[model samples]
Target chain A: MSKFIGLIRNEHMKTFRRLSTWIMFGIAAALLITIAAFTAYYAEDSSGDWRADTEQQMQDLQKQVENGDVEAAAVQQDLTTMQYQLDQDIAPVQSDSLASYMESVMYYCAPFLILFIAIIAGGLVSTEFGTGTIKLLLTKTPSRFSVLTSKYVSMFITTVIFFIFFIGFSFIVGGIFFGFNGFDAKSVIFDNGETVTNNLLASTMRDYGLNFVQTLIYATIAFALSTIFRNTALAIGFSIFISMFFPTISFILSRYDWSKYILFNNVDLTVYNPGNVPAVDGMTLGFSIVVMAIYFVIITVITWFSFMKRDVTA
Target chain B: MQKQPAVEIKQVTKVIRGRKIIDRVNFSIYPGEVFGFLGPNGAGKTTTIRMIVGLMGITDGDILIKGNSIKTSHGAAMKHIGAIVENPEMYKYLSGYLNLVHFARMSDGVDKERINEVIELVGLKNRINDKVKTYSLGMRQRLGIAQALLHRPDVLILDEPTNGLDPAGIREMRHYIRNLAEKEGLAVIVSSHLLSEMELMCDRIGVLQQGKMLGVQQVHEMSSEQTQMVSFQVEPLEQAAIVLRDMGSKKPEIKDKQIIIELTRDEIPAAAAKLAKEAISIYGIQAETKTLEDTFLELTGGKEIV
Candidate 1:
């Protein structure tokens, strides 16, 4: 119906023109840049500021080995062995530049777009309550379900675009700053001598593609919080707390065999492989996605019904 | 002239958080009738009005719009009802005409020409195309009326149309509301704390006090007791009392302008002639008219509505 569409358009405009939306974009940009900076620094810093003393010690050991120092030669040999092991651990490592830097950064940074955007998403519903716009809406048309749906439709559409925009922005930066040869770049060293390698383009594109579904879940959570709380500040607070802390609590719980059933335990799907020494018994990426999808749907359903029935008198 | 009610609110009681917001309020407004809900601030007028439009749920009773129960189907109940609880929110960025058109799209049984017709009916055709942000309070009020009537509702309930307006604006709103009831045969229930404004505008008023209707009476019928007021303010208000104390007049007291006398209809002219001879210049000769305010205070036992 044109009425429903008009409601959506108006709701969309409510988010698109806000200071918080732009602030979200700013946070997203800054996060991408910061994550890229951190990755770039982490990769090249061994011979640079962070590990200057280690590089100096290696040079000194090599000199001693050349000057017929037996103890120093042994230490120099150990140093070479350590370096070889480190190289083997980080096998298939790509060159560090702004482009490759950003690729690595986005894997972590894209998830945070949910946090940056959750504030506006909360405000999308809560503002009507705080500002008393619901009275205006109900006075004209009294169907509370339609009104709530219109708001969700607006945020759903906008959040999708926001997710797409960030993915697109990071990819553009990746293609421009890092060489296109990174189409095959993969494999990276992690702590504990672990190596993660894959077809860079396919996995990265898959992650980017999955972001559409992921952001929708986040948006629905934001909506449920908004409708339940009726205050933008409170809604955003709850959403942020859940997003940031849920995964952490789940990670700590993963030490127990029972922890794998926790929804947040499956958050880190990128490097996790069931065939490898998996953390939990029989937990797969498909199962986790399905579970999280159910959680999202349940929250959305509760929001819609509650919003329709609750009194907007206050 | 009498007609069937377009809106009926029966035994409605609304309690929120252990506080009774509306208590057993009952009234029915017929088509072509301008019903004024007279009350002071916090008198539960808005709550009652919101219930009529189906924006709120009644705690104890029901509202019928064109005989349709609000509880059973509010969307259909709302179809016959148009209302402004306060100033209805208009999209500030859009033109007034566009705003009406948008509301029209949501409502059933409205056409594009109806939108234009309502624009003309509210007498805002000249500036309906202007963005509402630029509209004056009066212009916006008119646009609000236009939107309320977009679906051709049978009953139009306005909480406070003249709120925050200058004298001229109040008069303009009064004229428009009365016209809507008269010309379009829309049943109108306008609530206001300003008794004088309601007196000037409303045909029949229901005085509300403490969430209860004190009584409903016509503007003329309220003052029809026909009190005779005679007043005179002398140097010593009690001094002139001694001279007129021995008269056939009963308990004549010196007030501001004339000596007070509650005279029979036949005695008014004779008393006035005697007072004139005594040089008590009759600046005015009229009954102490019972305004809606006086009626409210009189009916509420001199206590404020809230």
Candidate 2:
């Protein structure tokens, strides 16, 4: 077990040793600041205080209605009622993307950040073949499983540390500007045109926790891709493309329902919010979670086995 | 004394795609022995080494370390071994000591003292503090050997151990390796492309060609079972061989047209000095000795160097 952990620690050191990793840390910091700046500067002014705006607009509509215009009076009464419902319907929807974009930046940042991690890490596995270092590693350890386990463990711990920084930095940045008080999801709109509201804390926690887990998942997928492809640039490109496009692909696949089991479909932590499930008759966030979990396990298991069995004499 | 067979490869074969990379190889190396795996480029030396370490699987047959199958007890078998395959692919960002420290933590029964001892043993005491990137190629190789020796395993396998080293560096490495084998009684298998170096260093030599084992012979036996060598120096080497051939010198190797012979004082003086008298300027007169390279090419028919 100590041996296994050492192997893991070795890989973790590789990440730590790279200047690019620090560069990624710097990039993540910059991206978080950018998101903060973007959120503060151009975000819709009616973001969290939507109901207040509706109320204010209604008062002005009523004043104009009262100025001797009977036709306007009837319109104001209906308009005010409509405004109240519209506020109830729209504020939460607006808040969800706003929150998700924040989560998206935090949660999916691994894929974006993997643009750096994968290229650095791609050589970690393939280089053993290229350089013949795998022989040293295998001959020293007792088992290939332990050898590979150590590598994954090391990468996981490293990713966990980065996750701490990324999630912490994102929340801090989001809190200072966006005000973390409204992180709850009041309502969420499903891709299939359905709606569910009032999942506040559960949804918020899910999104927040998934921010870290998603990075791990992205890392694992990128790792497997990097191993299979043996090229860092392709791995990074594919990881970014898959992580970024999976949700959209899932959204488009909602017309087919069967495509829901795709791994990319559920990477969106916001998909687990209150209302993002497709009305594909039998699908739920649980199913998406199950699918992603399967992909994660399968990719990981295959990666472990393949690396151990590989003939790294390139 | 031979403690036991540390590693044994029996009729092992490896095929990639449609080609046989390694074919029906068989050999054994005992504890407290320095076995040299010698071959030329692409002769499957690396492939065979990898197979023994279980970095690769045998397409057929078995590889056993300390009498345990590398496939089944691979993890457990590795606890008995240490190896370096090629260029020292260590964590470049970590200091040499940190790298050793980290590798030490993985192997059982290795501690800080052991780490420091191995660092000193490899003669990297002063530079061990520097980052691996800052270390010279020779320093890196020494550090690599330090990491491999940290666990004090029963067997140490080094692939191309002396690949890139200056004379001083190679001397340092050879001293430490020989010391480990003699003083500690550690079994070692070192691969080298330089046959003369192997002849000088290894107890037994395994000649490899294109992934096949041509022969495994003791170093003394290889040298003792003399092959034909011609060793008379001739000025204007080209003119000498041509004249020797014209004189019905069957299978004669005429360098500068000066003939060298295995025959001692009697047979050599007549042919070589006679050639000298025949206008091949005999600046130096000497007998020929069989070098490992000549024996290797002769036995394997220069099949392939891997």
Candidate with maximal TM-score: 2
Q: What's the CA error at residue B61 for candidate 1, in Å? A: 2.7
For residues B1-306, what per-residue lDDT tens digits would candidate 1 score against the true structure? Answer: 556678888999999889987889888889998899877677788778877877777789888888888878878888888877777567776688877866776787679899988888888988988888899888888888888888988888887889888988888889888888889888889888777777777889997777888899887453323445445444344544554455434788655545675554455566556655666545565645444566678998998754
Candidate 1 TM-score, C-alpha based: 0.77
Candidate 1 lDDT for residue A281: 66
| DockQ per model, Cα | 0.32, 0.54
Write out the backbone clash pairs for model 1.
A99-A178, B231-B257, B231-B258, B232-B256, B232-B257, B232-B258, B233-B256, B233-B257
- For each candidate in turn, the interface RMSD (Å) is 2.8, 2.0
Q: How far off is residue B115 in model 2, in Å?
A: 1.2
Candidates' chain B TM-scores in the order shown: 0.84, 0.80
Model 2 in CAPRI terms: which quality?
Answer: medium
- TM-scores of chain A across candidates: 0.72, 0.70
Q: Candidate 2's error at B23, in angstroms?
A: 3.0
